[model samples]
Target: MKKEILGGLRFFLLMTVLCGGVYTLAVTGVAQLVFPHQANGSLMKEDSKVIGSSLIGQNFTDESYFHGRPSEVSQLSPYASEYKEMITERTQAIQEENGSTSAVPADLVMGSASGIDPHISVAGANYQAKRIADSRNVEIQRINDIIEANKEKDLLTGNEYINVLVVNAALNRLE
Candidate 1:
């Protein structure tokens, strides 16, 4: 019985080292080697200064900048009156801001679950492109070009999105 107990202890230690230490090191090394930028948080830098991460969203209320989804969306129950009211208000505000009499994109009114989703749908970006162009005093085509340049497409889902930070960063570079 004592020998059997010793064997079990050895096995446990071996597995712990292999799984916890060795396996972790291997995976981390591969990540660092192959995806260095992403492994390091996918941060965006400007003049050697860290501006933001490509993987996370930042709020931009300036009309000169393209906006992301409404970050202040309530997390209340969907059936709650407050949630409905908030959505209505956001939709109206988006319409007013974008001068669009048509339907607004759902993402513009709804908050992402993480509240840090960097990517907004192409439609959402397009909705605010006019406002951004007018505010920045740039041509609408220039804004469209920037949107196209920063657009990302998911291969599996075939969905297109644009990182707001990236777009805003590019906008900042405009003369």
Candidate 2:
């Protein structure tokens, strides 16, 4: 009985040290070395100031800037009635701007599964191109160029996406 109890305790300690300490350190060390930028949250900076992370979506509703998908958190407002009215008005404005009688793109009004997806479908970005172009005082062609330049394509997954935060930051840096 004594030997069995001692062996069990030894096994528990071994796992505790290996899984809890060594495994964690090894994984962290490898991540820090290999993916330092992403491991550090893929932060984007402007003028040496950290603006936002490319991996996270942000709320942008300015007439000049391209707006992201409707945030799920925004739906949790206490004033549900007012929120619905505001959203309806906002959607109407977008529809008018897009010159489309059909509904806006799903990604535009539908919050992503993560609720903070940084990338939006190319179509989603293009939907706001006109407004953003006019607001920035930059030609529409130049804005298109910026969008194409910053587009992300995954060869394996065949998924194309544009990181809104990164695109917006690049837009800010445009001469």
TM-score of each: 0.82, 0.77
Candidate 2 TM-score, true structure as reference: 0.77
Across 29-124, the per-residue lDDT of candidate 2 in tens digits comes to 999999999989989999999999888888877767767876574544646787667667767877887666666766776566677777787778
Clashing pairs in 1: none
Worst 10 residues of 2 by lDDT: 70-79
Among all candidates shown, the one with the greatest TM-score: 1
Best lDDT among the predictions, by candidate number: 1
Question: Each candidate's lDDT (Cα)?
Answer: 0.90, 0.80
Runs in model 2 deviating more than 4 A are 1-6, 73-90, 96-103, 154-159
Shift of residue 110 alpha carbon in model 2, Å: 1.8
lDDT of 1 by residue, 1-175 (tens): 9999999999999999999999999999999999999999999999999999988889988888888876664669999999999889989998998888889999989999888888799999999989988988889999999999999999999999999999999998986
Overall local distance difference test of candidate 1: 0.90
lDDT of 1 at 85: 94
Residue 28, model 2: lDDT of 89
